[model samples]
Each structure stands twice: as structure tokens, then as C-alpha cells.
Target: MSSTLHAEQPGTSSRGTPDRWESQRSFDELGRPLRDITFTVVDLETTGGSAEGGSMITEIGAVKVRGGEVLGEFQTLVDPRQPIPPFIAVLTGISNAMVADAPPVESALPAFLEFAAGTVLVAHNAPFDIGFLKYFCEQQGRPWPTFEVLDTARLARRVITKDDAPNCKLSSLARAFGSTTTPNHRALSDARATVDVLHGLMERLGGLGVHTLEELQTFSGRVSTAQRRKRHLAEGLPHAPGVYLFRDHERRVLYVGTSKDLRTRVRTYFTASETRSRMGEMVGIADSVTGIECATPLEAEVRELRLIAEHKPRYNRRSRFPEKTTFIKLTREPWPRLSLVKRVLDDDADYLGPFSSRKVAEKCLAALHDTFPLRQCSDRFGKTPSRTPCVLAELGRCLAPCDGTVDHDTYAAVVRQLRDSLLHRPDRVVEQINARMEALAADERFEEAGVHRDRLAAFIRAASRTQRLSALTRCPEVVAARRGDDGRWAVHVVRHGRLAAAGVIPPGTDAHTYVASLRASAETVAGGPGPVPVATAEETEKILRWLESPGIRLVDVEGEWVCPVDGATRHLALHDAVARSRTELVPFDDRRDLTPVHQPAR
Candidate 1:
């Protein structure tokens, strides 16, 4: 029988990574078949139940086999340098005298490991044997070699039943399968018996279509049959950074995601690792998984956001409603009231958001009102107004342009202050809010202070986000590079804060030539109307995050990329201060506090 997989010699690909051994063979692209997988069936007799309890291995035995044929055998007795308990000596028949003349573990373990190298480790209960080996390596200060392991007991529990075997014990299973060797508590005897039981279980699993090593490993888990049946969708996917879309029978996208390794990430959906409840349902109905390879992980992230926004897949909740984003629109009217709008138009009015929710936009609007007395009412009016005066006018909270109380020039001045606060001068508004909060705190009105604090935070956060995004969006073109782990530079071109093109330049390559080619092929973006470009807010936000990351070098820039000197980004510290205040423990209700004993309901 063949003892090794039908794999070709390893060779380097264009990317300087080893070519997949499975891809060059006539096997399932997902993984090698069970028959081609070699396994080392091992057994150990130790002095105690666990390695942590000071147990040490007394005897070790393993049989290296493939396709029901034994390729090699290993057995040794180790001088544990300690006394074996009476019960353990009786149970395993290995006594101190047996290992007194044997070699010590430091001398014996290396030989067994070399013999079992490059094969899957298997045992009746694998953790017991593997754990002891790992502990020995740790104690000896030797690094443990990574090995793929399988437990015969775990596999048996999935296929065998009480009716077939009275118990999952090695002796009971040997009898049930009519093994050629019966387990007798000795290491070699038990290991030989486990080999037969492993073959028996594999034969039973074969009927269930568990033909491949990957399937066998995942078979013991709670993977659904529907999920397993769709494993073929992961075939032929490049093991590169990319975006993947899971589509239904109608070719409609069901989900979209990004990963550094396409095949590994998509394959996890078919295994038990994908535990998200909705993902299982999505996989059940998914017909195919398609991959779009990217030059860098950042590009993959940008594509993922754009795809989710474009398709609005039912499985993707994030970035699905970029169109539904509400902005605090400073309307272009004689009485420019703050209006929460969903669409950003070319009307040349000032806008402050891309806020995810209307409630947040309203809070920001309230913050603006608290600072500048822009009209709150939505009524459009000419110079001569006909609407009734509201409470805000009586309280001097508004200029009350609706009753013709304030001229357009005066209201316009207040509007300019707000616009400057939104775009150019955020401190003009933040300082006043800070002063008001201090006054409220001085009056001991802590609850009202908290309310004002949160409102100011909302405005500062929105302003900061908008300013950061605008700084990138206003720039027509930006080229940046960051070195990757493989000594290559990942270069990307941004057009109006959207990832237009991306590529990688190998070490020692002419960066200028490569960047020129990237820029030439980049997507052309026309200047948009507002401070933000035509790109979706989420897309621009992702680009800005990548740009601000450490080690990102700006190779070239077209337009000026600068934030206002008094931009909201400068007030981020104050925003974070308010955010930190929320986590602090404070009195739940200042009005109703007991002094350990309710003092006369006062």
C-alpha cells in the first residue's frame, strides 16, 4: 500500500510561496483523500491520569500506517525517574523495574517523534498521549512540533453505538471489530488494536460520503449535511487575499466578505468553525462562492464594503444602507432651518453628517441649536413671514425670522457661524457648549449636565468624522505604499477617497515606474458637489482608516489634502473625555439618595 500521499515535489509559484501539494494531484481539491493520508497510531502508559498531576510516560508505542498497511513501528520504555503508583503499575503492567534499565525520556522521545514525523497522529484518546508529549517537550525546554491529530474515540462516538459496542473502551472496541490484536494495557498491544478500530470506523464513515481527510476531521463536529454538501464551492479558489460572495440559486448574492486567504476563509463556512446562526442558513441556500483576488488586504476591505453597499445582501447588515444615511442639512432658504435629509444634493447647502440614524442627527441638530439659535421649525418663508411666533422666540432661543423679528442678514450671520463651526471652526461651538456644561455642573444639576454632555459629544464626533473623511475626499488623487510581510510594497491609488487601483511591487523594483502604471489605470473620479466626494461614506471612511495607519507613506498627491486649522479633529480629545465620563460610576438619581438609612423621606 502507498504510505505517502500522491503529491508532487514542492515548487515555488510566481508569488514565491510553495505550490499546494493537493492541487498537483488527482485528489479532491479541498484536501487529500483518507486513503492517501498516513496516520501514526500511538499509545502511552503513564504513571497518573494527567501530565499536570506529575504523571510521566513509562511506555510509548506507535504504528505508522497508510491504506491498511503498516509502514513502520516504534516502541520504547522510558525511565520516568519517579515511582509508579501501585494501582497504575497494576493497570498497565509497567513497573519501576521494567523502566529501571530502560533509557530516560530525554533519550527516547526524540527517536519516536522522528519516526512519526510528517504523519497525522492518532490514538484511542489522543489528548492523553499528545498532552503528555507536549508537557514533556515543555519541561525539557524543547519546542513541540505542530502535528495534525485525530482521536479514534472521538471518531468512534460519531459512528459507533452502544448496540455495536458495549463501550468505547479500547478492549471493547477491539472485540466489537474482531481486531487481529486484543488490547492488553501494554503500549504496543493497545496501539495495534487501535489501528484495527480506526480502519473499522473509516469503513463505516465511507458509506456516509466522508471520503476526504478534511471531511473526516470535521465529521465528529456538528456540521450540517447541507453545509458539507456545499464544500465543492470552495474548490478552485485562489489562496490569496480577496473578496468572496456567496450567491443563491438565482445568482443573487446572499453574503459578501473579505479574507487574507480566500480558500481557507470560504472553507470554514462548510466546517463547524462558522458558528454564526444566520451563516448556517445562508450556507444552506448558497449555490456558489465566487472570489475576486486583490493585491492587498486593504483593497479587499474596500471591495467588500463597496460590494455590500451595491448588493445590499440580506445576510450583510453593515454597509448595506449607505443610501439611507441621514445628514443634518443646513437648508438653503431665507430661514435656513436644520433639516435631516437622506440625500445629499448639488444645491450648495452646508451639510454636517452621514449619520447612521435619525436620532443621532437630531441630537447633533439639538447641539447646534444649543450653541447657535438657528430656527428649529421646518417652515420655508420669504422676508415677510406669516407663521405664528413659537416658545423659542419668547425664550430668546431663536432669532424668530418667521415673525420678521430678525433680518436675513442677522440670521445669515448666525448661519455663517454654524457653517464655520461645521467646516472651518469647530471650537467656536465646542467652547460655548463646554462653558454651558460647566455652569450646569456648578449648579449641581448633574442629570441635565449629562444630557448636555452627550449632545455635545454627538456633534463633536460627527464633526470629527466628517472632517477626517473630507480631508481625503477633497484630494483628487492620492498614491500610498506600505511594505508587506513578504518584503513587497503594496501600493494603492485613491481617487476622491475611493480605492481606484491597487498592486504590489516586489523588493528592488522601480517604485516610480510601478506607481505610474497604477495611476494610469486608476478609476477616474469627477469632483462632487459637497465637501464629501461621490464615494459612499463607508468607503471613504475605510480609505481614511488605511491612510492613517502607521507606516503608510504618501507617494504622491494631486490636490491639497489638509484639514482646517480649527477642524473638529482638534476637538477629538474633548469628545473622548465625554465618552469616558459615561463609563464612570455616578449617582443614579441625585434627587433620591439614601444615607445608608432613609432619613425621614427628605
Candidate 2:
């Protein structure tokens, strides 16, 4: 992590001015040669996953290198202020005691920033490390210094082939190249390993004619020759936040994407940075790229969803199939049963979804059936006893409405409860399902309990999302504003959950006048059939995400925008915890060491 370059590179003199070699050596106009650029390779170990969620950096390690020689190193452990999660502590071997006496981020950040000043920053996964640094600076009210960033993993992806290494992970690349140090999860060790991987990748860059830093930045090892030939397609695109559409020879859209910088993002399609094989193929077939600039990132996002849904692009996988979403319907019959339907009709049937998939909708319906005595059979009853009771009735799983065991009025009451649980109130449903799960677990029915747990999670999440979206769409007019980092305000006019209009208000502009004008010019959107909005659920859901994000303020509202008190919001944490357990492959019953361990100050 520490070495000195005795010979101060061929281009510069001892006094730090350019020498004769600087003028004679050929270089690209975009930037300096890679050999002359100084890069500060950095790595950080944090208390947990996200900075915004109060996850703090536990250790910082960086190595400054230029011309393949390490210039200096900086490493320090920081007291996170909050206790570290036991899993994180075990991962990095940095227990609470290890950082008890160390400086906190308030003291440690400035030192690292100063140590790595005036140099390009490099990290294996640059976003995670850089995000923590940027967030810390914001919290401290310190101006983050502008520094060029290069991800070694991205660099490796551009240079190293699958034959050379399996993946771009630091350890993998370190082993691929005969590195002197091995990454051991500790910050300094990983940073040192990354420096070796960087050098090895730089060496391979020469064969690809990536001598200049600019060329190296855009180089991708797997980018085909055909992709490079279509680089001109990105020309004339504005470098602003918006949506971009890649069109085929017939002017049909092949793909749609949103980006903060339209030109840079579209340009990546022809470069190694665009790694998705499907995207590369799309770019190969693309005859042109069109950019639609928007006032804010929120608008860009909504526009992207709309464009993708409209075009149903072959290359885009997500929003293209939004119509395939299903809904859990309370059947409009004498003895109503839960049914899955594709569309929302005006038949007065209680609906709880627009679920992302049929499997999730089925899970939600299963939860309802497990809790209530709703008929499991699909047979329609004509008020009187028409058919024999099924086994579900004998097992006490159903009310046997078909055989007159349960009257229409009683069955209707149960249907009302189910609808209320799915829509306005979910507390009873949550309690009932949770109690069932506990009872099964008490009986040592772990597998059955696990199934119940998943169904409960799916039910709650779907209920929460549906209620949140429904509340927004129910509002006739809603106006909101979010202040950007640049001191401008992004104002949005939502009419029945559709983005009617979007604009930005400058710092000095009068907010009142600007908002009024935006509202006046906004689109006149009528309420759609039933509880839905004029916009699609996916589009409205995107608007809801922006409305709920931090810094968003409701400027005005024409109608009520509220979720029920006993709604799914209360159970959202349980849903999140269940999802996290499933993702981490942890047993649902194992709650130990998941919470932060507050070791007494050493």
C-alpha cells in the first residue's frame, strides 16, 4: 500500500512542469495519458448496507499511485457512533472494541479527503464507497471536492475477458493477476489488492489501444466492432436528464432508457460500458437514438415508463409487460369467492391488486382464504342449496355456502370483512395470519409456517402498494415540489395520479406565481373508470415514489390523500424483514445477531 516513485514520470520535470517529452508524446485531445494520471485507489468497510439508512463507514483505506508506483497510503478506523451489526462485524473482523478509541467520521473524513486531493478516485465498486463519502460530506455540511472517478471493476470488465477471469470482483482479479496481496475483507488489504488489479488491467489496455485516460474510461473488452461503428448515433443528444429511445431502421423503438446525462448514457451503448448482451444486440440493430429532455429526473422516470409501455420495446423487459399484471377480485355473485382478474370493471366488485404477477396475486388470495371461511370451490351458487358441500367444509376450511350451511347474508358479511382488510383496514387480517403462523410454529410445523409467512408478506406488500396508489389516484388534483441540490425546485402537477405537467422553478423566482402558472397549463385529466386513474398503475406508482421521497413537499391538494389508519403501513416493516431474510437465505426463526449489538464503550 506504500511505495515511492523515484523517477517523476517521463512527461514532467523535477519542478513539476511539463518537459520536452510531454509535447513530443502523442496523446488524445479528450484527456491526458493513463500513465501520467494519478489515481487514489480507495476501499471502505461500513457498519451496514446503506448510508441513508444510518449505515456508517467503519474503516477507510486508500492508496495513491501514479506511473505504476504507489505514492502514499491512508488507512483509519472510525467510530460509527452507532453499534455495528454483528454480521457486519464478523464480515470485516472490526468489532465495536476495535473502533471504540478511534476517531469518528467527523474527524476521520477530512483527513482522508485531504490525503487523496487533486487525484482521480478508483474503487472496485466505486458507487458504494463514493456514495458513503458524498453522504457524509452532505451530513457534515461540507462541500465535497470534485474528483474524477474510475471503477477498477468497470475497467477490468473492459479489459479482462471471461477466459482471463470469471468476474470483476477484486479477489477474482487479484487471483487472475499474480497479486502480492490478497483481499481479506479488511479495507487496507482489499485496497492493496485492487491496486495490483488496476495495474494488471492497465497493462492489458495497451493491446486495445487505450493509451489515453479518455479511451480507457470508455473502453469495454466485450464491445463488438459493430457497436463501435454505430457510435455516431449518440451524436447531438443533449447532456441533460431525460429519456432516450433507440430506434431500428424502420423508425420503430427498440429500447427506451432514462439518464441524468442523455449524451453520455446513449454514448455508452457503443462503448464497453454497455455490458448487457441484449442491449448490445439492440444497439447493433438500432439505426438512431432520440432524446426527450425533461425538467427533472422525476419527469424523466415517468416518461421512460410511459414510453416503454407504449412502445413495448423488444429490448426492454420491465415496463413492457405491465398490462400482464393481475388483480385479486372479490367476485360479484350471491356467494362471492376470491377470483383473479386482469382488468378493473365497473361491476362493483372489490378489487385488491394490479399485482405484478399472477403468482403474487394467488399468494394474496391464499392468505385471504386461509383466514376467512370463503368458498374455495369455483362453483357459483344460486342463493338456495344447489350442490353438495366439498371436503373443505368438512375440514372446517370453508363456510359451505353452496349447501346452505352458511346463509347469503353471513357469507356477504365475510366478503365485506375481506374487502375491508384488503382495502381500508388490514390490521385484523395481519393479526389472524400472524397468529396462525405462530400456532403452526408451536406445533413444529416449520415448513407450513414458512409458507404462511411468505403469503402474509405478499398480501401485506400488495395491500400497501395498492392502497398507496389508490389514495393518490383518488385525489382530483395534487401539487408537490422538491428542492434539488442546485437550489432549484422541481414542481409537479398531478391530476388524478397522472403527471399533468412538470416544471422547474429557479431560486429567485416567486414560488406562488410559478406554481399557479403550472397548474393553469396542466393537462385536464378526467377520472378514469372505477378507482383507477387516467394513467397506468405503473406510471402512477412512479409518481407516488417521487411524492414519497425525501425533500418532497405537498404544495397544494384538492382532494383527500390518505391511507387508512389500520392499513398495511403498520405491517410494512414485517414485510421488509421477511424479504430481507429470504434474500440473505437466513432462516425466518433466526432473529439473533440481526439487530445491532451495542457493546458498552471499552
Candidate 3:
């Protein structure tokens, strides 16, 4: 993008002298306007490109200007709490090491706001930088200032003939404006260059109805005729699941969302009386709306989440849910057992889960012990020299670690077995059930076989309920499901032990893709070793890689575990050819009947 000005000539002005501002004649020589106005030229070095969602600014620099002269400046480094990508480090030279000790955004935003008070904000790409500022301010519950924004880039495009310019980058603009060589990508230097470019643009556009700060702010805030046209355009959207975007006249994004009924949701914003209250003010200020429609609600939700995480929309609120949800951690001690707790501790223990609630955690632990029978007593139970093997041992619930009969290895083995059961690989349980039922039937023990069959049914029910958060899928899939504002529900399908499909489900759609996505996912996970517990950062990364793989197809489906394409069979073939390969099929919940079926050759 070009700067708003063209260079006249380079001449040293006494403008930089500390005491020059005190002379009234100096102000006149500088052609200072009589109007009372303020502008702050700002720049930021961020974690990386795409300021859409979670990407953060690591450094900010601002220089305040009035009339046509520079006044003062502000600059600071911010901690983004995420690793700066390698490409960013190479370009900006703001290394991860340099920012390791920097203060977080919460500590620096107030100071930046204080410096920017009562000023029209100006930047090279004003929308990109200011959009993040607005988002940050809103998250902190601080009122967002309605400052008039000026983009030197946009202004340059208006004045400089596209073919005549060497390049529209800030560096090119600086050189064209006769600015001395300044450090590139450094926030302060870039801010200074932007100021110089703006001054030049104003001089060139002088007599052509060039807008003043007040005029620009009014234009930026008014609901323009063009915006009405765009809203009308949005009215023609289909009433199907998808993601939608709202943009200003300059095409800067204002909001992002997903809905099962796209037209209905978008229309609601235009019709709601409260639209004037929450987002209406911003929407009214917008000049146009853009959207991308998906085939399913799940697809819409997935796309919405990805966009929100990527673009960090000023008005979008769903991206913050991951940090707010709670999970349960199981300690990995020698006789390591399970406990319902919040937050993962650094103690020597393997984390079992991140459940939605304490009640869910308790239920999971109870069901697990009932099926697998690991020790539930504390370490202190056997150390006190108990007179009899604890009640749990007498009831055949535990091996009685308290009796000193079960060896440490044997006890640890049982614990591992329990862990495997909770992880949802019930092959051992299945084998045990099959063996007992067969022995009883062989002896004509029908009643015993029936009891074993019931036990096996209970085990299947328990196993099905096991929640698989990041299970790999069989195809490249996207499922879109809406939870509460803070809750996220996703189904990942793993085929041949690899992620095949994944997605978020937007609200509404109750059949088709939702069921197909689940069945495909289950087939993928069952086709492999099933879903394994992700415990460490490396494991988490592995799961993420699988989910993000290009080969994985994300689909939106409804009702748990139903086939997405053919609904005739509730059972998904876990051993299907696509699933039998290295790809594994994993499902969110066993809400659908996924029993394996054998077909006779045609």
C-alpha cells in the first residue's frame, strides 16, 4: 500500500529543536492549522501475520501529532504468552529470548491507551493494527475509543499512480517522502516513517476536498448508503449452515460467526431492535458484509472456530472458551490411582482427563473401578498394618495391596490395566467376557453365560460413554456443533489410526453429515488401536497434527454414532478397508450403535 503523500523536497527544519515549539513563528512556518485536532501515528511488531484471532502484538510504538508537527512519542514491548514463529523472529528480530522477560499485555495496554488518549489513530495498515487494539480493549472490559483512523497505505493508493510507484511498502513510502534511512519493521521507526508519509499525502491532496480528522471519524462511524446496499445483498443468503463475515467500507472485518440458518441469523441482526444496542452500532458503521456457506452446521462451526482462532474478530466471543474449560487429572504415582480434581498439577502423575464437570469425573471413576477394579484406597490404607484385607479385597473389588500379598509389579500392572480400560481399549475386557461366556456354555451353564453376557453389555455401555476429545478420523472431515458460549463439542474421525476427519457442529442440523461424520470417525478409530490418552505436549501436538492434517475431511453430522451416508445400518465397520490401514477411526461419544457386522459374499 502507498503512503498518502508525495515528496516536495528535503530541507532541514528547526522542528526537531527542543525549544522550537515555544516560538509562535515556528508554528506558522510549519503551516500549522488553527483547528484543535490530535493524531497518533502508531506501529506494532506482532507475534506474526494474520491478526484475525489469537495472534498477539509484542511491541507497540506511537507518536502523537497535532496540526502538522510532531509532539511526543510512546513505545513498549509486550509478552504474547506464545512462541513467536521463526519467520517473525527473522523479519522483526524480536526473538523469543528477548521477550521472555517482557510484561504481558494486561500490564502494557493501559499505558498505551494513556499515551493515545484524545488522538486520531494513524498507521501504515491502520485497520490491521487497530482491529487488534479494539479486540484487546474489549476483552479487558475497557471502553474502546472511537478514534478516527487514517491509513497511510490507503491514502498513498489514492494519490500515487499504481504503475509509477516503486512499491507501496512503508520503506518505499519513506524513501519517496525524502525520509532518512530508518530501521525497518522496528515499531518506533515505522511509526515515525508513517507520520512523515501522512504529512506528504496531506500536502499533495491539499485542495481536493481532502477530509479532516472530524470528517473522517464521521464517515467511519456513519451507516452509509453503501452499507445499506450490502445489507440488502446479505438478505439474499441461503437459510443453510455456514460462516458469515461483516466488513467495513474499507473491507476491514468487524465480526465472524456461524449459524445453522445463515439468512435467518443475519436478518435477525438487521431486524432486532437491540441491534442498535450491541453490534448494531458497529454493523451500522460497516459498508458491506461477506460470507462463506457450508453444506452442514458442523462444517459451519468448524470454519467459524478456525476463523475466530485465526482472525481474532473485534466482536467475536467464542475463541476464549479453550482456556476456561476444566479437566480432571489422574496422578501417576507408584500405586498411582484416580482422583477428581481441577487443574493439572506438576506432580509425578499421568493425567487421565479433562472432563466437563466434577460429577462427570466422579461418574467416570466409579464406572471405571466397577469394570476394571483398580485400588481405590489411599496409600496410607495398607501402611497402618490392617488386621484384615480391606473390605474392598473381601468383596473381590481389589487385589488387596493392603494385605502385602499383591506384589508391587502386580499392583502396578493392574493400575496400568485400569488406565487402558479408561482409555477405551477394552480388548482385554472383551477377551475376558468372551472366555467366561464360552466356558459356561461349554458346560451347559446357561444361567452363568447369561450373567456374563449382562456384564459384557454393561462393559460395552461404559466403554461407549468414554469421551474421546481428540480422536483421529478416517477422512478429512469438519463437524460443527455448538455448545454453550464456553463449551466446545467436536467429533474427530480416525481411520487406520490416523485422523481422517474432524469438525465443529453449528447449532440445528440433526441428521445427515452429523451422523455420517460420527460413523466415519468411529470406524476410523476402531480400525486402529482406538483413541489413546494424550498426556504431554508432544502427545497433544501429535493429536493436533492429526486433526489439522490436510488428508482429514471435516464433516458436520447429527445424533451420536450414526452413519453419515447410509443410515440403514447403525453399526459402522471398524475393520473397513479405509479404517484397517494406518488410519484409525475415533468418535466423540458412543451414542450410536457401532457393533461390527459380517456380510455374506454376494
Backbone N/Cα/C clashes per model: 0, 2, 76
Best by lDDT: 2
lDDT of each: 0.80, 0.81, 0.57
Maximum-TM-score candidate = 2
> What is the C-alpha lDDT profile of model 2 across 1-602, one tens digit per residue?
99766767667878556876445443335468888999999999887657887678899999999999999999999999988653344346677888999999999999999999999999887877898999999999999999999887656654555667666667778999989999877889989998998888778666555677887776643667999999998889998999999999999999999999999999988876666556767888999999999999989998999899889998776789777878888888888888888888878777787788899888888988888889978876588976788999999999998778988888889888988898888877788877776666557565677677778878898888888888988899999999898878999999998999999996688999999999999999987644454777878888988898999999999999998987997767635633532232211111111122244676
By summed lDDT, the worst window of 10 consecutive residues in model 1 runs over: 586-595
lDDT for 20 in candidate 2 is: 68
Model 2 residue 491 CA deviation in Å: 1.5
Candidates in descending TM-score order? 2, 1, 3
How should the candidates be ordered by lDDT, best one leading? 2, 1, 3
For each of the candidates, the C-alpha root-mean-square deviation to the true structure, in angstroms, is 22.0, 12.4, 24.9
Native-structure RMSD, model 2: 12.4
**Candidate 1 regions with alpha-carbon error over 4 angstroms:** 1-222, 384-388, 441-444, 506-508, 573-602
1-602 per-residue lDDT for model 3 (tens digits): 77555444344244343454446555544442323567899988876443554678889888898877779989888888998743344446577777888888887888988899877788886766787788788888999987767777765654554333465567767777876546467789889888888777666554443345533321211233433444574676787678988777787777887887788777655542221233655666666667788744544655676576567767665462433323434556555666665555545454444544455455545545655656677665433334467688889988776666677787777877765654546666656655766666557565666555444444343343223333322223334322423343455543332333545555575546675746555423333111232222222334544445554444543233321231111111221211221111111111111122344578
How accurate locally is residue 118 in candidate 1, as Cα lDDT from 0 to 100? 92
